[model samples]
Target: MARTDTAFRVIAVPPARAFAALVDPAALTAWLPPEGMSGRFDHFDARPGGAYRMVLTYADASAAPGKATPGSDVVEARFVDIVPGVRVEQAVDFVSEDPAFAGTMLMVWEVTGVEGGTRVDIRAHDVPAGISAEDHAEGLASSLANLAAYLER
Candidate 1:
């Protein structure tokens, strides 16, 4: 069995702003990063069973396709739970013919009401055997940093 890890960060923007930064496709693009990467929401019904998909492109030519990390060039997911303006949970999986995923990636993006803004907690489970918990952790942190930057701007 693979181990699952939780990554969390408390955003400083107000709830509305934080939430806006979350659901707004443009806002998400502004911060979602790692060089050569961008994403768009396919259909954010924002409720359970609502489907969502995103495209991730390799920014670097030197990187092999198999080396494309999670959220690197492609991601498709569905909302597992949504609490309007409060929280959004997702079941995410990698969409790849890369022979790596073999199946969909399962993940959750949880937003909670905090003192000033919202707390973001990302739980990624059933991670592929080759995936790196440390790299994912760094990526999560970077994304949160980008989110903060976008929200504050």
Candidate 2:
């Protein structure tokens, strides 16, 4: 069976602003990486049918080895659906030699206006078995926290 991981955060920004950050490579690189990791984009095109490649590097490889490389996790993602100021859906694949990590994961990011700000929801489906549930949950929470901090500043 496929696994799904979800997370949400109320950011102190409007839906449009949050949506902008989702498609902006610079903004994504600033907030998408979890704690103890940094990210860089090899290429980014934010539009339907467009794709992006991102490399996330762990600060301490000894603590957690990467899926793609010893210290980095490389991801190639295609934009499956893009609704400005509303939602962004993607098909993501990890660049890994391990067969356990070989599969496309569906990711949906939705932003809706809330009372104080915008609510950002992230749903990741078909997460690879190579990624532990606990680690995935922690990573999702960390990224959401980072997004909140980035937008609230």
Return the top candidate by lDDT.
2
How many Å off is the CA of 104 in candidate 2? Answer: 0.3
The sequence of per-residue lDDT tens digits that candidate 1 reaches over residues 120-151 is 87777777655577867777788888887777
Model 2 regions lying over 4 Å from their true place: none
Q: Tell how far residue 60 is off in model 2, in angstroms.
A: 0.5
Q: Scored by CA lDDT, what does every candidate get?
A: 0.68, 0.96
- Which pairs of residues collide in model 1? 56-73, 92-105, 93-105, 94-105
- Report the alpha-carbon TM-score of model 2 versus the true structure: 0.98
Task: Estimate, for each residue in 1-153, the C-alpha lDDT of model 2 and write its tens digit.
Answer: 999999999998989999999999999999999999999999999999999999999999999999989999999999999998899999999999999998999999999999999999999999999989999999999999999999999
Q: TM-scores, in order shown? A: 0.78, 0.98
